[model samples]
Target: MATTILETCRVPAPPGAAANLSLPLTFFDIQWLHFHPIRHLLFYDYPCSKPYFLETVAPKLKESLSLTLRHYLPLAGNLIFPLNSEKKPEIQYVAGDSAVSLTIAESASDFDHLTGNHARDADQFYEFVPEIDPVTDESEYQRVPVVALKVTLFTGRGICVGFANLHCLGDASSVVGFIKAWASISKLGGDEEEFLTKHAESLPILDRSVINDPLGIDTIFWKVIRDVPLKSSSFPLPTNRVRATYILRQADIEKLKDLVLAKKPGLLQVSSFVVTASYVWTCFVKSEEQVDDDDVLQVFIFAADIRARIDPPVPASYFGNCLAYGLAKIEHKQLVGGEGFVIAAEAIADQIKNRLNNKDQVLKGAENWLSETKEMTAIRAFGVSGSPKFDLCSADFGWGRARKLETVSIDGEKHSMSLCKSRDSEGGLEVGISLPKARMDAFAAIFEEGLRF
Candidate 1:
């Protein structure tokens, strides 16, 4: 049988390999690397557990996924394969992790079909769950992906994502490169907005204050950075990228605090970003379309930080959306005013202000929501963005920050953006976008005009 570059693996490490050999990876390999060659594949001997409504799935998924991964990730970094070498394909992985990589059928089409079904199940669950109550309660305004919902995450389903499996090591780029190549993606014009991310070390580094936690999420994050590489990489990618961090500038934060306090005293504690963000989404939708309230102007999906929104913020950053999707639909006539966009944004802003400030509104509401778990299913944010020191440019454990950072939307259509800060503050952000060509043009026109802060 003939072997191609794509099929061969685990050859003896070549002597005198390129000392600083870069990734055997790149982004979304719609070509050679198919959908996640690195399977964080969890197998079950039995059939998938019976389906409960999404209401049942929501509260349990994050906690359960976290718990499941923690058990599997016993060592320092479970999913992360260390490339702590100058050698080509920089070696990484635990003792037997490699054997698991080999335990697969020659054909992956089987896994794809199975997981595809699971993904459809996930979408069906979302379709049935009530659209989150919009300020206008317009069905058209509820948040949802225009195209596809991924069923990859469901247990017992086939593989959807690659963990830092044995063969390739680095980060999400490895995953993307493999998937893009696999899908044989051949678009040349590109969608950088949906694909801008940098390795942490790529940017000029800065110092900041520390937060304490014994076994907390932040601690785990910093742990991931212990030997974080301080260089950068040049992986050419075709996706939007973002970094994850919680550090807000003192001055920027103070300005925000003042804005919140003037609106309602002592209200700076909640995510003021939500207020501004909701305002952004509302205005963005209204400005683009002429559809009426019945037409549903909803687009941006605002994810709630349900933790801080709770009695006190949870000690850890919980994965999965502990968020609520609130839609804002304006009657067509009301939207005809000259300043309708601003007015719509202000209205959304005011709702958030009141909800967050009305005597620990977030906490009380969280408690109430948790109390009524069975009846609270609704569409929520599933995309993730990070500003972690190196989630973008400095994420190099060695090779360098990934050439790109991005989120794989469960929704097949690319309708989201990832915002990463840039030294080019003149532009102020290195925005990696990934919308279809048409939507990309429309969005660029909006930002080029510089929407108000």
Candidate 2:
């Protein structure tokens, strides 16, 4: 697919939002300071004239986004690490003229194939996602935009809205909230002030002080990230890398859960996540025949939300990162063994349970784990990224809900999968997996055969 940029302009926040403003970063936010920005693209099939979109749809989207930024002003700001200040890095919102970059473009790709459920070239989707330039020099305070957007027109078919946001600003929950609010404003189509006032409850809370870090994890996290070199985004993927989406119907999910339970009748928790994740992990490991080595270790790492787990529970809508890492390590032989799926399920479930039940201990362990494994990377790791709880398909932008939603950012990372609620709303699950072209066929076979068993 080829994309041609038509125009690029800055969309600033509403009036009075352009003053020098700074919001302190919480420990939760500090943890993700060095992580890559989140990239998401929502596809819609408009089948309308481009003229109509330019005159009506595009205007409303831009205006709604501008109004939306009033509530989410931090997104229109910059993240800075001050050299002279003793405090941690903060996001500075500058008023007057500073704005979020919005790029309007056109693509020549097949809209149907791009939005279809089947797998396609992962590289094609890259053109739809906007880039957020990172600050390279850390000597002095440098300004970097927290968000950027691109809206690509597919000529006569539809449009794709690509959004990019810094990880330190918020988590998946915050991103969903912001998108929904923008869509609601676009659908209402009236006085922006009255709309915001009417939907006042949708606004996010920016007070980082509410997140009390009694253990001083923020300082430790900063120290750890400061010493580590920033990761380059230009890393090349294997020549044969491919991306595909696999759907596990409700019946398939139940069957997998039953299979795991049948193996170990004493096992009490075989939730959908455990069953689904374990099945995918097993398939991945089995596809790589090299995992048969007894000395090799396979690790599974995932993040669990700590908003409700923390003392004085943070609100579900609390803006910023609030997650703890869950790690499970096992020998390669044990994972590829006959009862691999069952064992994997138990391990993942136990890790999640421990993190939830022992929040403080898990946080400390994560801190220590990061401190010890400074040289290790995710090349040999397997984990899940998106959550079924996010319900991404429901996001409507006046026209209708998205025909397809994808986490294109995961394409660069190996052995990482994206999960979300199925579009049918039938309690099923959608799993997006990326792998080498040679292994995809094997992975698909194992994935299907394991479920059948």
Candidate 3:
């Protein structure tokens, strides 16, 4: 395959170390693939070893060995986690796919090179190697391996710090360039990064047609507000990384259903976005801004399992993008309407019904949000995950069930939000939520109040 020309430069010194691929995540590492270490993990490194990432993508990808693998085949839609939930998740090797089968470990050590079985031993997985700058003799970059251990195993502070992979998965090619640039600087003696980044921000914040939430950043807006998925939108993946997983809880789900019941029927049977909506509002949708008549809008967006919701459930293992929208947008007054929790419940439910039931529309209008090309139109977007056909509750490793599972996200100049589910000490569900620092503080306060109400 041919290569494209990406911007390159000497690595920066001292304060100007080259930026490496910022992605990080330990997929099979946590939740151990449906809570069973026996299941396979298609582990992959950051696609950061390449040069000319921005420019030569087409050529390299054309010549890429994976092209020999198979077409861009979407994974199965109805296939639940743990393949067999009652047991651990395991995938037999299949030929002709870029995705690979993970070899299970008798213990987690199979995944990480660490000493002793100490909780901190997982730290070795995050060991970043430094890249020397081309300009300065100083190593201009340090790409530490990421910590893929369970967040619950760590403090709130630690999970808060695990944003690197999130950034990487969001854009893998960029990750490739970043790491290569760093490697070049670290080993080739160049500026830490293509000088553009160092001088780019200082140059200007160009204003254009793009609009954003009041917070003025894309990630922040996605944090608290729920978003719906586009027809082709992907499940959570890091900015520049490849692997990802989606996990939820059973009991908290019970709490969600109860909240929705106050308003509409067929809710528990509604889309996952519907279930997630109640949690989003109950946790923090209370009038952060109401004076200007701008009632807080919690836009919930996620895919509806169109395959199953319409009628008989799709085959237990049916795969493909058989999903539609569970889109809903509610105003704060209506969300916290005077009628009480019952009122709030009904209003949000009504909002979801309005979207899903409207004009035979599911995305409400988000089509290009997941576009693969620039020519693709950009759809107006809302944040909410669609419902899943797979069983999140049953994802068990040989150890029983995943003690904890989080829909990992990465933070940048902006931030992201994902879900987490931990097994109860007694082997049930314990849900945990993570958002931007600014918002999480507010969420804690609301959780305190939610428990009261």
For model 1, the local distance difference test gives 0.28
Worst 10 residues of 1 by lDDT: 26-35
Clash numbers, per candidate: 61, 3, 72
RMSD of each: 20.1, 2.4, 19.7
Once fitted onto the true fold, the runs of candidate 2 whose alpha carbons sit more than 4 angstroms away are 84-87, 134-139, 190-199, 227-240, 359-362, 372-379
TM-score of each: 0.36, 0.92, 0.40
Candidate 3 residue-wise lDDT, 197-275, digit = tens: 4433322111112111233222322221212211211223232321222223455456656655655565534434445
| Winner by lDDT between candidate 3 and candidate 2 | 2
Q: Across residues 1-453, which tens digit of lDDT does each residue of candidate 2 receive?
A: 399887788888877664766888877787777767778888887776777877887888888888888888888888876555455788888787457889988888899998777658777788898877656556765567888899989988998999888788888888878888887788888367676676777578887777877778777777756554444333233325677888899999998888888887877657888899988988899888564357677888877778888776787777778877777777788888998888899888888776655755656655565543333363368878879787766767766878778887677655688888887648889888877777887888898887777
Comparing 2 and 3 on TM-score, the stronger one? 2
Model 1 C-alpha lDDT per residue in residues 1-453, reported as the tens digit of each score: 111111211211122222221112211010111112222222112223323312333223222222222212211121222234332111222333311111111222333333221112212212111111111122222111001112122334321222232211222332233223212111111222222232122211111111112333322332333243322111113333221211123344345445545555533333434433433343334335345354433333333334344443432222112233233445545534444444444545555565643434543433233223322223212122322222233322112222323332322323333444443222233333334344445544553343424
What local lDDT score does residue 62 receive in model 2, on the 0 to 100 scale?
87
Alpha-carbon lDDT, every model: 0.28, 0.78, 0.29
Q: Give me the displacement of residue 200 in model 2, in angstroms.
A: 3.5
